[model samples]
Target chain A: MKPFSTMKLAVAFGTAALAALLTAPANAAIVLGGDNGWEVSYGGFINLFFTQSDFDSQVPACAGPTCSEDSTHMQEGLLPAFHTLTAKSPEIGGLKGTAQITFAPDSSGSKAQRLNKGGAMIDMREVFFNVSGDFGTISAGRTLALFQRQAILKDMTLFGVGALVGPDGGGTSLGRIGFGYVYPDFRTRFTYKTNDINGFNLEVGLFDPQETTGTAAEETDTPQFQTEMTYTTGFEGGSFNAWAGFLWQELEVQASTGGATGDIESFGWNVGVDVKMGGFNVVGSYYDGQALGTLLFPNVAQSYACDAFNCEEAENDGFYVQGTYTFNGKTKLGVSYGESNQDGTATGAPESDNSLWTVGVYHDINSWLKVVAEYDHQDSETLGNEADIFGVGGFILW
Target chain B: MFSKINIVRFLLALLVTASWSPLARADEDIWKSGLNLYVRLTEQDDAASGRPVPNQHPVNLDPAAIANSLIDIQVWDKHWFKKDEIEEVFSPEQARLLGQQLAIALRKASPGQDIVFAVSRTDTKFLGFRDLSYTAGRAFYSNDRLNIIIGDFMRPPDKFQERATSSAGVMEIKYYFRHGRRDDPSDFESAVMTGDGVEVYNEGGKRRLDWLVIDVNRASAARLAEEKAGEEANAPVSDEALRQEAARFAQERREMRLEMARMRKEVGSGQTGAESTAPIESRLKTLDELRQKKLISDEEYERKRQDILNDL
Candidate 1:
């Protein structure tokens, strides 16, 4: 259904209909359901932030079974500014829509650079409609993949660590405009919300990379998929929330002779808690997953866990501690420290561990506006390392 | 005589409430949102034409109020007796000045509340079992007699007070007059009152009259009042003040009559032990006490008291 168009029609006709019903005399015989209904509200927020990071060339890198130090391969700090716009529709028929567009400036800053920037100036961050009721909510269109669900809850911030992860790996932003569907995945979902069971709630969704417009080579163009499940509940004033999920990807690597490639699957699970006491909140979680076979870079001859279907795997595990305090009814200060260890069959990739620490402050300008500034730093102890980023962004919506 | 005691108790409640009752004038019961104030009239202690309630007796306040921090009851004030002096002796202008002074004190005691006496005439309370009174009397007392001896003199002549200690004097005042009766107490109290007449007086002044029509709903009252006016029963209700007053009276009368019918229907309902908000017997006893004490107009007492019980 064209939800947007349908919403427009409902809004157009709802005004006169409401007036007529309210003005009508009251009678027990007539059911006055929609007369008391209200129209939806609309608002949105956008945030743009500039980040500059300098990498030290002294970081050590070793290769082969022995230690062989590499020369200083470093460049000056790079400055990148990313801007995103998020818009939301007022809730109608228990459904609301959201869309986000991200833009980044190109170097050679002026008009000449824009001409040769190769359409890289803009990106679709998130665009989807969420339909929900007492039964359950569904989101169809391009949105966060399943792998991001658990992390999304843990990260708390929409534009944080969880959003960057592709669910299986620690942080991999994959596939623009992925198709996401949340079915009553019994394992990961609450099937009885409509029936009113209060103790537990669960949900599961799968994100597939199949384009909106079908392509002839379906197998070749079909994007990798991820599935996730989450459960949440509250007991005796404390809440318990948990989630787990997996991702599968296909990489048709360049063949040594004939072109041939295989797909790979990676799975992970996350468990976390939000313990609240007085005004202080403490969060803790443990996540472990494996990235096996040739998931990223393909090995053509390796029979690697080969069945008629081809797939590889890798393993990773991480945990984090985050806390936030709210006061003055407007601003909140938060800090989190996390570490993850990534290990795989690939060489020079020895149990690579990464640590992330972030401190941020968020000020709610008003009910519909908020300003956020956060400093995030990551230290990777492996080959493809030397990567650190700082992000400060803000969002608004109504 | 038994009924007279209840009346005295009822009036004493009124007297005590009048002289020292925390029922009103102190601006003590300040309420915040989300908190409900439920009133249950336990019993009446004393009833008389004029009684001096000196110091307010301290009682064990509701513990729930502390946690809720939102609900409370200003049951009794020690200065209630002294406070009533202003109402009894001061002229309108004087009363206004006194009201202003008390208002300041009230503001100091309970901020955010307009410091004004809780109007006694319009507000109703169950003085005892089957006894109800709408009379006004001085109800205040100091926290201490400054030298009064601790004795049984404090206890009110009621089931709950009988079992309570003399220190319960303040409690008796608080429970019987100031606060509503408690749901549970340490006694097998017979919530009954036997009395002769009821009294009615239009102490009606400038105050918000919360007219409760026992059994009449809003629609029915409007319909009845309209029909009486010889207007189309379904005519749109005018927003005029006079029409609103008529509609209000119609509702109140309907409620009174409906309450009476409901009592008749429940005559053999076999329900016992504080079924009504206030016992009908209590109202009867209070009237008897008032008549014996000559504290109220006999005709008014008889007429209004019966008006109350006839509903039962």
Candidate 2:
């Protein structure tokens, strides 16, 4: 019940929570160009999974004396079906521009009961435009925020399900949001990225401020700032990618309304590395911050625990390590484990921890199709609940 | 509410119908009888052993590669012709050099005949009950020319392993020399051009062609020119088709302009205070030049001018 309550709250605030994997090769997409130099491309994938989950007895839904501890459902995995359209403009006066729009639709409805047509939902997760020239690129509009972006992108669960919220949960299943890292939930921001120099690039953005639930600190005059730096290099048979990200923001607690009027400073930082050699890949990432929330950045609802007279910012940290081996350029086997811990500021509040283990097998039928089978075990220490889920699915990409 | 069987039947019907379509018939006719071209494998050399290998004939090339390369060649050369499904592949700079080497081989083969050259890949596929051959590369001959068709097939896997991994496939050169009727009436009666195949040697992962010799006379050249001219004059465009084309062009132009306007907005907004105004000035000059050239109307130019000025 506790895990479900937290998950429901996350679902309510996390709009189209999954981020598109940015590591797919550019040539994999379909591009249409004309003699006039402008080009448009279309790319995305649709995936569906049949999953059977076994929940903890204490977390089962009960009707009278009857209790149900297991459920089977056809649903989307960590990623919803995505359809993205990108348009690029010809270079004019040394400046080139691109605009992208992505739509994610759930494969199943939210209702616990089947065959509910009206329960399906579509989320416009990305609507952004960017301009680039010799200097760098400046992006505007809503997109995946920068904080902890690399961690999720590098997670093997990006291609397979790692965690399940519930049998009939809406949107996309949570891969490792609460288990290993906080969701970088897409946000509206204006960011500038420097041109790659010696395989290193820096990006900084000013995001629309976030609100803390029940903190009475909604009034914020300063935009939240986020920045990330990454370095990439390759050897004869291997490659490496290392990244670091930082986030900072301040919230003003209104005294006139209730509680003490003061500024609560929230900050977070993360570092991650990914290495690939021949057929093997390894990734490790860690994050530490205050008021950052265990599941979502800035912990919109629980960033700070407030009393009638004062408020204290909560502390959160998490890490995940994963490894995978690809065989003959087609099939991949992977395993990963991660944990996230939260220290609430409310007096005598118990520390909460969430962890997950995922083992998966993914096979590419061709360049545009893939099949996946996965098993996941998730544990919520504070709530004394656990779940085991098994799923099988396939994806069609264009 | 179609049943599953009905859906399957519908799909099968579509496939069968497509195989018998007019275009499909044309493709078959062209590859079989359109031109009297012949391709023969003359030599197979092993690069690793540095010896002329024997008894290796009819090498199978990747059908997909041949089809793709043929389509690319036809589009690039603006010449369309279908040949027997043979096989081959290459890049542009290498293609240019290969063309030159092919031209030299044609000169040596025919001595005095004008030579027209074309490169293409070959494809073979099976229809429901018949084997259909498709050739996708450029093929043309004109003005007393010796038409040389260089059909390369996929290198044998064993042979490929002998060369560097970066090596492109071996190119087999088959040259056709047309003899005049007056000089060789018996040869002209056969309707098939006679040619000699050159030995293709693989040296350091590159293909080398030996010289070829064949006989050519002048009379057969004019006949092929007339054939090419007839093929060059395609069907005339209908008035309705012209209207549709014009409308599509107009729509594309309108979209390009709208895209340009949006890009200008993005560029203007991204500018920082410390940045120089040189870029804005340069853009204005470019806009004026476009107007002077009548690329953009005066009214459109003025609107854009105001937008650029607003950026300042």
Top candidate, metric TM-score: 2
Please state the i-RMS of candidate 2.
25.5
What would the per-residue lDDT of candidate 1 be over residues B125-207, giving only the tens digit for each residue?
Answer: 13322311111112111321111111011112222111111111111111212221111111111111110111111123411
What TM-score fits each model? 0.38, 0.54
Worst 10 residues of 2 chain A by lDDT: A18-27
Instruction: Return the clash pairs for model 2, or none.
Output: B70-B136, B87-B152, B87-B153, B144-B221
Task: List the candidate 2 regions with Cα displacement exceeding 4 Å.
Answer: A1-35, A57-68, A111-121, A213-217, A255-261, A346-350, A381-384, B1-312
Quantify all predictions' global Cα lDDT against the true fold. 0.34, 0.56
lDDT tens digits, residues B109-210, model 2? 222222222233232323332221222122212222222233222211111111111111101111222211111111101011111111122246532221
- Of all native A–B interface contacts, model 1 reproduces a fraction of 0.00
lDDT of 1 by residue, A1-398 (tens): 11345533653475446335333322223222334332222222333333333333224654453332222211111111223344444445544333333333422222223332345444333344334444544443443344434443334343322111111121112110010111111111111111112222333333343321233321322233344444444322134555454444333322212222343333444566656442356777666555421112112122123333333344566677778875643667788776666554432223556565667776765444456666655554532333244445444332
Place model 1 in a CAPRI quality band. incorrect
Q: Compute the DockQ of candidate 2.
A: 0.01
In candidate 1, position A327 carries an lDDT of 64
For every candidate in turn, the CA RMSD to the true structure comes to 27.2, 27.6
